[model samples]
Structures are given as structure tokens and as C-alpha cells.
Target: MSEFGNLVDSIEIPLRWGDQDAYGHANNTVYFRFFEEARITWLDSVPMKTAPKGTGPIIIKTSATFLKELNYPATVQVRTYAGKAGNTSLESWYEIFDSKTGVKYAEGYAKIVWFDHETRKSTRLPDELRALAAE
Candidate 1:
């Protein structure tokens, strides 16, 4: 797993009206998008390796643990980090927090497996890639 020093990567997202649910807060599904945006942004900013051009990584498993509610007109700061690295997959963790208050509103994690474009099967993570992540 990569050791980052409280290195938070964030993006500003406006709560859409459609994002609301019966609970009167941003719908749970929207949080996934926020998490995705955060993770992509973080990856783009860092010197990290991505799954090759055509083939993309697939989520083997995913989970979310909601901590609190988020309302409309609020901007969320989504944060992401690489948590655990494995032979064929890596664990990614995320958190959505209030942009102003910095209070964590939701947290989630995903296990992504690399794949070969042509073979359409899962592949082991490259050793160099793992080492890069560890740094």
C-alpha cells in the first residue's frame, strides 16, 4: 500500500437537485460518482501507473459506509488513496467530506483487478507498479 502523508486529493461537486432522495440528502448513488471523481483526480495528479490504454481495471468488489448526510448547494471534497496492494488487485479507499467543514460524510472502498485487453481476463499487477504504489 502507498503511504501518503495526509495527502488529500479533492474535487468540487455541486449537489444536483436530482441527487436528493427521500432522506432529503444527496442520494447514495451520487456518492459513488463523487468517489470515482476523487479517485481519478488523485491518480492523475500522482505519478501512478494506470491500466494500459485500451484495457481498463474492473471492480471485483465494492462497498460503502455512509457516516452522515449531505445536502444540496453544498460542495463536497472527495478524497482517495491506495490502501492495500495485492498480486492481482489493489484496494482503493475514499471519503466524501464537506468542502468547508472538512467533516467526513461518507466513506467507501473498492477492490479493482487489472485485466488484459485481448485476453479479457484478470492479470497480476506488475512488480514495478506495486513498488511505485508503495512509494
Candidate 2:
């Protein structure tokens, strides 16, 4: 975890050419995409009775802090972590950096709420996820 929170999952994604902006660097929105990819991957890996269409996780908030410029032609890794778990919410954090040199490009987090699609309200987190966050 190394002070980033409990390690949940990580993934390496190649920077695509279209990821760059007119400034020749990765656009600000790219960081959010990286975080989203990692989060989705993690969610797919977990075992839970509810699905996104049923009762599942939804991001209530998300933010990122850019540290360095990211460019194309590089493979970057995003390290995901479970920060804090409330009764019906969890904080998911991420660190995106170059996979080769391990240079951190950005750090971000998303506040996820276990939500019911029909009721359109928050629900208690799944037991599997609660156990994961306890770790």
C-alpha cells in the first residue's frame, strides 16, 4: 500500500496517439480515463451479487492531481487502492505513472456509492467489497 491505501488492483495501459492534445502531451481528461479503466477492471474482478444494472457501484465524485506531463509511445501503469469504506460508500484511489521508469504522472480518487438502480438511492456496500476494503 505504501501510504497510498490498501492495494486493490493495478493495470498497464499503452498511451494511444489520440490521447495527446495540441500541446503534444496527454490531455487532462486522459488521467480520468486511466482511473476509470483501472476501476472497472477491479470491479469486474470482484465477486458481488449485484450488477451495475442492478445494485452496484456508482461514482459520486472524482478528482485528480496531475504531477507530470504524460506523452504518447509509453506504457503507463495505474495502481488502484481502496481508501476508506463507509456503510454505503467507499473511496477508491489511483496512482498513474510510467510503467518503465515508475515516474508518477498523476494521482486521483473516486467516491463510490453502492446504489440501487430502481430506487435510485444509496445502499450498503456488498459484503465482498466490505471485506476487501477492510484489508
Question: Which ranges in model 1 have alpha carbons more than 4 Å from their true place?
Answer: 1-8, 45-53, 126-129, 132-135
Task: For each of the candidates, give the backbone clash count.
Answer: 0, 0
State the lDDT at 120 in candidate 1. Answer: 80
TM-score against native, each model: 0.79, 0.94
Question: Which digits, one per residue and each the tens of the lDDT, describe model 2 over residues 12-34?
Answer: 99999999999999999999999
Model 1 residue 125 distance off true place after TM-score fit, in angstroms: 2.1
Global CA lDDT of candidate 2, please? 0.90
TM-score of 2: 0.94
Best by lDDT: 2
- The RMSD (Cα, Å) of candidate 2 is 1.7
Give per-model CA RMSD.
Answer: 3.3, 1.7
On TM-score, the leading prediction is 2
lDDT of 1 at 17: 87
